[model samples]
Target: MSANKKKNLNSMEEDPTADDSDSSSEDDDDDEPHPDAYTGNEEVEIDFEGRAPTDPDCHGISQLLQRVFLRAPINTMQMADMIIAQNYVGSVICQCEPDGAESDMDDDMVEEGTIFGITTVINMTAKKDIACIEQLRGYIIQRAEKNAPDSVLTHLRDVLGNEGRPVGFLINERFINIPAQISVPLLENLHKEVLTAKQKGMQFNFSYFIMIVKFYRKEARKGKPAEDTYTNAEEEVICSKAVNSFEYSVADECDVGMSGDWLEGDATLTPYRKIILLDAKDLPHLIDDIRNYISGV
Candidate 1:
């Protein structure tokens, strides 16, 4: 990773809660109602005996309330006025889209690394916390789509099966920082685990990953010296600037490998978005001396 890329990661990964705390507090305070104001808890009689016809468009609570409010001694407008007189607000609540349905679907699509209608799972062992892993998965997908459009995401799936279970590595919240330390193992272990499976007659679409996540320092000046010095004290995990998808697997380099045959030019140093592609050599070195290499990056 370049210095600028690391800076960008820092900005993205910076702890959101740490910045300009007073300004955020003020924004929260602005949304609150006056302390002296009180919302009424008094309940109105439904007046079922004086029920009125329901509107065709009305549904659920609205339909039930229509029977009472439309014909009751007090109409809807009158009820609204009463609430306003008490310094309270009212809104006609309506059903919205099913909660979290769209978000869940998007998360699934990302976690599966679905691209060009193909789905690949990265690590089989990393599925303990479905929600957290899904979140990280979604983040990776969005970043890849935005940054690594032309790059091919090296797709790999467990040969055992791809149903009713997680197929990718467990991604934790801590991946935002110390990327090389935490993430390199994920890719390394993934290759080893799946290769072992392949030796046992397990088949997969693709294999191996040369992935590294690195973070760097950034500084800015705000005119005043005191305000000018800004460091990423709150580490934030941001999208990788360099993402390269390859068709090569490190396992293929092994002569005795059962699944893949060695092929030259299989690995392409393609840039993801404008970010430079990671070198094939970088993968092994980072795995071997991740702390030292990340520090130098």
Candidate 2:
């Protein structure tokens, strides 16, 4: 990745946590609940609601996608709209409103909803004609061709190019600090939603799943070489659940987020993107693994 792109990605990824920390320090010094106070640690009832994306959600969805795509030249707004239009798949994470809350708030007075996380699947084979989908497909293929080994490259081509076997691009994104516990319900619900959609004759009958997962490569330590670590640690469960899978690193073309302060001693961190291809049948197993991993089983 170019230096500018790396800088941009790092800024986007780190700014939220930095701002949160600042807000927390300020909140701790005061006894009052300020408008901008951080209450992330407080116990509150939240819901993993399944809802279709609407016009108002386009901006938030696009913002979440920016972290995934980095500085890639994909029209995330259009991609968000596509996800919204599909409507049959995906779920959004939101804080539940208390019962007996007044419904008289004006549109302008109401705050813009926060989309804590989203997990969904997009039909890459069936929706290849869409502009943003086409862009995403071309981008993935380009990166794989440039960085992946010949074996992985051949496998990717066979899977994505096969007309009879549809593939789903699984999207799992959230704020960097969102707890893994949230992922368990989100993924479990996604599996159920996908099954329900298929039962209703929707086009969610995917044969293979393609995931572009984020991870960090801890720089070499002592005599040991660099090793990969999951950015979302829970995703390690998904990797373990895959039976027939192919993975390749695309860190060369992607941005590597900040590393200096987050490291210790001489060791540094290099952010990377890994493309994983797995059978769709493993979705249930993956969900189980995530639940077990998060629950510390």
Candidate 3:
């Protein structure tokens, strides 16, 4: 209500539990940033874009929301919408009316947990039915800004099928299923077809699951990593090896009714089809998988 309070409420706070819900907008005085999001930070006013700036200090805002989205009892569609609305397509963003009372702010943030918003950001445009899940993922890895040292991100265009269990991209020319009932041609089309309007553009970037195999260093087998020795692991090698052992690309696994055996039977003609334009960088890993599968390796 008062200009002084409004200014304080709009600024991000230090606790990391500040609320941002406009549910109380009907109550004139209830509109303001959660103390956690506005405290101990710059005293700048809200930007034209409601979201926080993409600054080093404010990087945790998005990460906080991402944690809430992922852990809350919500669906992917809801998560997508919330993220898009909050980010406003490159627009700055801010929290809505605080989610709880001043006294309860700490509890709310504790429930939501601490946020690390400076994840890699992505921009993509799909066409027809392009396979992008892989590309989305590659971009996350390629653009990572955090020192996660343990995770990678991936993104892709919308490519839904009759089911939505294992999300994938149109990376391979075919699909591969464990039991092998999905269709190769249809999956190919799914990979190629852009369900969302490529006219404007559609893309989602999320962290990829990490798969690591540990080998005790010849010296580490004797003790904890030497205090002065910098710990290191070859990510590229790990990425390459983990992929090499896979039997199919996201394309092949996601294709309608593709099966490892079915693809093999059609080897006389190479059923593979490049229905979608793929990120050249992620191709080698994909190619190696298909080649190995074909060789029954």
Candidate 4:
């Protein structure tokens, strides 16, 4: 993996929730200078590096995981530890600081760096013995049985219950405002890493992949029907490539604490979780579709 790759931010979107009042300008005489005259935007460059999650990254990794499993009784810290311990198949995204910025600090004393995103796969069949993994497996099954269609339920049981068919839970998580473009490189690298692990005789060989995707349905208004929006839009592209997928509302199951600004308004939105199953052989195609969708190709 490249240790210090740089990406231009010109194509990235600004935070939608950011306060625009600071940039607002008052009208001025044609000849006089306006205090907040609009200036041309400059292209910003950011350096992002991918590295194996380590002991020091648990806190940062867990924080990101918490957002995904909100109100669910999963132990995110243990899950983070498992990701770090696996070490061979996943990556955590971190910003690359300038050289020598922390030269004075001892190596051990270096701060737990910020984590921008994480992508990894957990072998559900192999890791069933783990407490957190078991908890998650049971949670998914319970939710599906309660909310998903019979077809989805039967498919999940056939795959998860059969020891010969290993299922991988793919986790793609990040902060709310991160652009979909960052996901392209992260997912591509994850595919390469998993293949390399399989070649090393690791237990990464799998029959199917299960992904829990986050999305919200915007309430209908003015005679228009409700609309659903994917929080990470690129995942929608992956869903298009899936063999089977189903969505269920989590609004009743989630705690009040899970509600955010998006849920508050006259035309309120409802949050839903979509479960998608894809053949392992089709992962490459899904990744390619995500790349194309994000690039507007």
Candidate 5:
């Protein structure tokens, strides 16, 4: 992890900043939120009235809400207004619905590496409590460490999984590797725990992930030709609801989301949005475009 890049995935910091590369763990002790930040108690708290969303397979909450809002026969401004009134921030809510329903499918991605996706953003609230933000951060850290025989992870996944609340994670690609047998017991443990959290009116998070995959090359046939190529022979257990449809076992390389942080923001004058259902890497450049548009440059 470059000490300089202090955003999600690479960010171990509670706050994201331009000069965060030099920051040490001790630096987060301050009570200050960032200059462009707005923090608040963010939740969707859907009663569901014994009904899931029209499309429940979609794993991202922000994505789910956006779709529901858009499909409700309301204008953009009206839908935006509803989102703000609900105190909604970015979150990935995992839900498994009965078959044949409108799908709320956010993208499902898997990769092999120590690096993965996680993000940090500033909240915009006048009455926002910084302590709440700090407390939230502490809670997340504690969540990750609750599991014992903790994998290569220095932190436990529980502290990070906090009810599917979109949290952030810091991944040092250099921090992950496997020499002995790779038994994904931790991921299996996480899948079960996520269901329990939802039963009690909570959401499971999908922000930070630590992905490590091992691969081997073999021979195979494609239609008429036979070829021996690389394949993944290991079975990776994942939280089914955390993501959409996925294969139970693959042999080439195994990638699973690791631990991380969720972002909460405020929108009083303008509408606030986080967890846009779009991948962070995709949106960053667009955000740059928006900034340029805002400046009339």
Candidate 6:
């Protein structure tokens, strides 16, 4: 390659899809301004540090990867290593690369005049975890940048040690499946824990609240006293009533489970309650209305 060719290659590698627009808007490029400076309409990049294992990092990049890992046919561990090696952390952009045969060049762009494979630009860091994030970030940025420069861009600080699902729980608490009959008390306990975490400025990722109830009838015992037999109709009636009443106070049930009662004992009911899983966007509202949630929000 001639000296000019070598210089051009280096430049293309530096920024294969660099925009050279002369727009005066700071949002057009990678410049930070005062929080209030930019209008909300303009494209901007923001970073967030979430508190829950499921809370998406920044632009849901990590969460997207997690979903991909779960469904991907390839080895997750190897993919993680590849991502890290490519320094694919932070905001990633995915966009088309142009071919060299095309002589037409957008003079305003700093990109190479040639087309290539899709470009993924990383922040380029020594830390494997950080690099992984940057690689993703670059991939996302490129995709978004393919359109107008103002289309999309996002980023997040590194947290994962290795690529897998983020490993953190709300206040580091484990979730348990219990009967809905005790949801009130359990919710109250969660309210307390959440309130304390909020006071200390902590973050967590459990955001859903759920409840399920099953009813059964008691069968007559030959050796033992007859357990009261609650009929299936009676069980259904009770479960339906409970669900209807709970919806008024708590979130509407996204799903519900029901089962016939086991023979023996007075008709019996078991309610499985799961707190609604929340997203990062919903955390503040949850923290503020935790009392309402406990009481019947």
**lDDT of each prediction vs. the true structure?**
0.25, 0.63, 0.26, 0.71, 0.23, 0.25
What is every candidate's alpha-carbon RMSD to the true fold?
Answer: 25.0, 9.7, 21.6, 8.6, 24.0, 26.7
The parts of candidate 5 lying over 4 Å away from their true place are 1-184, 205-216, 219-233, 236-297
List model 1 lDDT by residue over 144-184, tens digit each.
Answer: 45544443432322211334333332111121111223333
**Clashes per prediction?**
7, 0, 42, 0, 40, 56
Best by TM-score: 4
Q: lDDT score, residue 50, model 6?
A: 12
Candidate with top lDDT is 4
- TM-score of each prediction: 0.24, 0.75, 0.21, 0.80, 0.18, 0.19
Stronger candidate by lDDT (2 vs 5)? 2
Candidate 3 regions off by >4 Å? 1-75, 79-187, 194-288, 294-297
Q: Supply candidate 1's per-residue lDDT for 275.
A: 17
Worst 10 residues of 1 by lDDT: 44-53
Give the range of the ten consecutive residues with the poorest summed lDDT in model 4: 31-40
For candidate 2, the TM-score is 0.75
lDDT of 2 by residue, 174-239 (tens): 655445666766676678778988999988999998887777777687999978777567877776
219: Cα error in model 3, Å: 16
Expressed as tens digits, the lDDT of each residue in 1-297 for candidate 5 is 122212111112122222323322233223111211111222111110111112222222232222212222223233223223322222111122224663332112111111111112222121124443344344333433442234412333332334443532211011111101111222222333344554765533334332222222222336544222111111112121122111111211111111111111111111111111122232233333433443456
Better of 5 and 6 by TM-score: 6
